[model samples]
Target: MKCYLVPCVAGFIAFNENLDIVDYELFPRRSIISKLLEFEKGLTAEEEKIIKRLLKDYGKISIESVHRWKYGKFKGVILESPNIGGEYLRENLREILKEIGFIKDGEFQEIIYEIHMGMTIKRLEESFREQDKLIIQAVSTLDDLDESIGKFVERIREWYSIYFPELESVKDHEHYVKLITEHPRREDIIKLKKLPRESMGAELEEEDIEIIREFARAIRSLQLLRKSIEGYIESKMGYLAPNLRDVAGTTLGAKLIAHAGSMKKLALLPSSTIQVMGAEKALFRHLRRGSKPPKHGLIYQHPLVRGSNWRVRGKIARVLASKISLAVRKDVFTGEYDPNIKEDLYKRVSIIREKPKKKGKKRR
Candidate 1:
């Protein structure tokens, strides 16, 4: 099997150029509220109907997410058609807003801010537990990898706590070494001790045995999860964007949204591209300005560079892009794309583009 290693220079150059495209050459935004106000004064009855519909379904818009959408802080804003139960729900919702002092004079900003703050507080309180669970789940998912690696890391930490009080934790290097020797699989240690020059045991102190055991356990755990953890981190980062691991560590999670592209393309994208996608303001700017899009996110993952020897990679990219474009057009990410999608699209493109048979043309 062959693997393509992304050249450091290529990734860096692509990233810097991408940053320039986003940071300096994006378009301006026009406010929807301002547009609405203009329409309020001059709108026709049909326009009025649409405005009422928007008002009716306003609750579906998350207050904070909407605020971001309004300010053009988010990349996409998809609105579903309003349903029948509008007025009754709005009236009851208005009453609740009034009780909370958010309806009178209609302090939309204040209400949004309050909801955002509430969510933030809730998330902060839950983060530690969430992270611990993620760690365990990540460890368990690596079935093909060695399980001893995880056990080793755990035992190392445990032994450090047992022996070294001042260090207070097994995370240190000294503690790791101490733990490894202490629990050096007894059979292996005995064989080593029987040698003429003898093993390192003569130099090891009594406290070191437990510490060495703990160290070995820690190393073993790490070994078990090494490859899977790399894949896990890649998958994890895809949830946000690429390149975040280097910047944000393992805590904050990936920042990109689902529309950026599918997980496969995202995993293949360079970090710079991911960051560019996350810069919603710039991306939306290009899109709204009717210019060539900065890149519809993972669409760039298609191997269509202007100059590249890897024609095969480009073909693969085109196929992937075509599928992704179809997914996006159908709003499949939102679960609205066809369920029997395979049957629906069978040779659809080929059928449409196939050339007609010519007169007197012989069958090849």
Candidate 2:
């Protein structure tokens, strides 16, 4: 007397304990994609309506599904059943559709292919709409820019030092580049910066100064581009993951997302994994050699962990990672900005900092 529900792309099919078709509900042909999307997320309104109709006749029913979401929805109304009929239904699905006039005899495979293609396209569009991918690209580009700028700045310093060694003391790369581009002549730079008139470095030809000035201009453009990308990441992080931004800071949060491949993937990671995200090599070494495990990873970039005393840094990293985990989940699921996460993280970090340092035993 028990009835089992088997969900399919075409619709929901009911079969008796003997695997005989007892009741069924078919989705509208045009709405199958939408209904299937809803089903993938959980149960759909169509499913509820059909289940209610069946319950009126059968009193109670059973669902043979592996999806936990189904169990959550039907807890009180339906008995959770073993998947006894699932295999039979899957194997015989094409024939069942043909018998029920859902598809013509020759078109079952063709129709199924079309439905799958539609679902794939719909899912792809949804993935493209998310902004996390933009953040990943921006952060990756920013890191590349930082590396390239560092190398170029060093080269510029060395090359320009040949003509005006004193400018090397400027220290700041942007200011150094500005001086070279704006006042390529060593005498002009000395006059502008109020340095001594006597020059120990070699004098460069006008042609040589022009080339160095051109190179400095290019470096300046790159610096500007790097700044623009950083600004983009800050704004995107504020919009997409405010809680994660507040907890981890914009650049670190974006790096975490890039390392995980997506915000959703980052959100799925447990606190332990998040703590050691960028230290994969160290983790593997520990696993293979039984050496001391790393105390922190990319989370070490957080000021709380980096500035804490070595004795309590590991503890602070753990607390920070836990808060990051909560922040990520809230950002991904609730999208609500909760300031308490930041407050609680700082409070716990302060408590760890206050503990007295343990004195080590003196060597004999």
Candidate 3:
């Protein structure tokens, strides 16, 4: 008698070629969904017990691919080919299962609904556990804050230049804002910063100084917000992807994750893809127009890549991308920090830096 073992949401069922139930094992009512999920992943202990019990009576049995993991030790166990007896069992097993009181009129539908809900909740919980989503948002907010601060600083410079044009010499936006906010009068600024008292710009009314000071205060607030977002990104990257953070700094690592959509997606990408992730437009232009391919993308922001000689940046970018790939994989899979990744990366970069520059032919 050829017997087949079929797994159901309720439990495991063994039957003969004629669809006669030879033996069965039903899980507890409360654990039906949990057991079903475990069974989907692999053969569970409950399944092994039932299979062992049936093996005592049945000389030969066929099992599905999911159960093949444990098939090596079991004698007389055959792996059922695709769409063979298993399909027939699946088609007719519902009726047989209902007849045997394993499930009632509406119980099967309920089990399926519960399983769907359970899996959906599981996926949602996993997503929540991963901080990539938070990192993406933080990076985006940081970018927006940067743009806002830039525009506001430009406006402040223009407005303040009307009163104290000498202040325009201060290139740092934060210092410029501070100078105006603390001392709204041109005389006060010149005396405090030790500048000449010559006046090329018009003297503003107290009202105008107040207005510029308020504008500068708003820009200062934005700068503070930008710093806070940067700190948030650093904390999140340290916790979620310490290896990536170590390989790439906090801001660059967060940008990579944001551009890749998520850490899981980034971890799966090839080194080449990761290297050009933020330069999709340039890559597409190269493919479409036969232009020279880009040597690097967002990773160009990294000191190791950016500070290198232009001629060798491509090689360094390639090496950096490869190390980043390994780092991200370890971050996602093992969650253990390996210090060698950073050390090896620096070693390779130094070797590339030491290579002699190629000599060019003299012009005739």
Candidate 4:
């Protein structure tokens, strides 16, 4: 209650038990909470302590008092009170209050309201941070899964090479994986008919095939997990950053948000910062060594940038970064999804994707 009254005409009524006026001027400066308290004039040190203690547990803040103050509930009290002190305070302080611009805007009252009732925002932000960590962790797992799947498949080829070198030469990575999973034994693989009519691969015993099958089974499981994480990322990113997802696609969009640490932090960034989404190492190197800064970063992974020729990668990245900046702001502030933004951005990207023209040599 004192927090709101600190700015009202009644704020002047503060007194200690001895009835001595406690000047609002006593509030300390150079501290975070004191700065928030700056809306009030000259709050005393004791009052600042109470506010700090109350704020330590957001639930303790007075909601009713904040609601009343947020609507300028005391404005009528100061104006309508017939009391001489109220009239004097109102007349003498009106100019100062107007000068402070509190009368011109309800922004200060809104801040007070938020302080009293903004606990949910803290919880939601915590939830957002947890989700980002989980997404990053899942993405890392998927990356590892990819590497493991590759290595396991390569081993599968080597293991079967002596028995069915012909199969290794004929089948591509995917088909070989499928054949191993479905027909681990040489007898089974050659039963239907190999790709080539001539059996170039030596026949293997059923036991040799069983050993290979165990490894194939594990790799197949890893692939399924990778697919699951990809889908999970897509669904979660859509929920967390819908506009970013629409503009950047789920995986890259989540990567961008995760890289930024939080949506609010990302939204606060300038378009230039968004431009260099993931080139921290290169950027730091350039800054330290006075080397030429790279034009693009991980944003090059965006389809528009990646598909474009190197000559135009920088241009496409710039445009994409600018659009992503706008999209991120939209998602963070309004949570509104506008398809036109995505469509227009891709249209512009298409034009940028065109190969740069070669310059002809000039004759003197």
Best-performing candidate as measured by lDDT: 2
**Residue-level lDDT tens digits of model 3 in 145-235:** 6787788788888888888888888898899998888888889889988888896899778878886787676677667657866887888
User: What is the Cα-based TM-score of model 1?
Assistant: 0.24
Distance (Å) between predicted and true CA of 30, model 2? 42
Q: Cα lDDT for residue 243, model 4?
A: 84
Give the Cα error of residue 324 in candidate 3, in Å.
0.9
Q: What TM-score would candidate 4 get against the native? A: 0.59
Tens-digit lDDT track of model 4 for 17-58: 232223333223223243334433344445445445434433
Tens digits of per-residue lDDT for model 2 on 185-304?
Answer: 988888899987887788889888887887787788778767877888899999999999999999899999999999999999999999999999999999999988988899999999
Of candidate 3, the 10-residue stretch with the lowest lDDT total is: 119-128
Give all candidates' CA lDDT scores.
0.36, 0.84, 0.81, 0.61
Descending-TM-score candidate ranking: 2, 3, 4, 1
TM-score-better candidate, 2 vs 4: 2
For candidate 1, give the lDDT.
Answer: 0.36
- Give candidate 4's total backbone clashes: 4
- CA RMSD (A), model 4: 24.0
Off by over 4 Å in 3: 1-129, 359-364
Quote the positional error of residue 350 for candidate 3 in Å.
0.7
Number of clashing residue pairs, candidate 3: 0
Work out the TM-score per prediction.
Answer: 0.24, 0.64, 0.64, 0.59
Superposed model 4: Cα runs more than 4 Å off: 1-129, 169-172, 191-194, 353-364
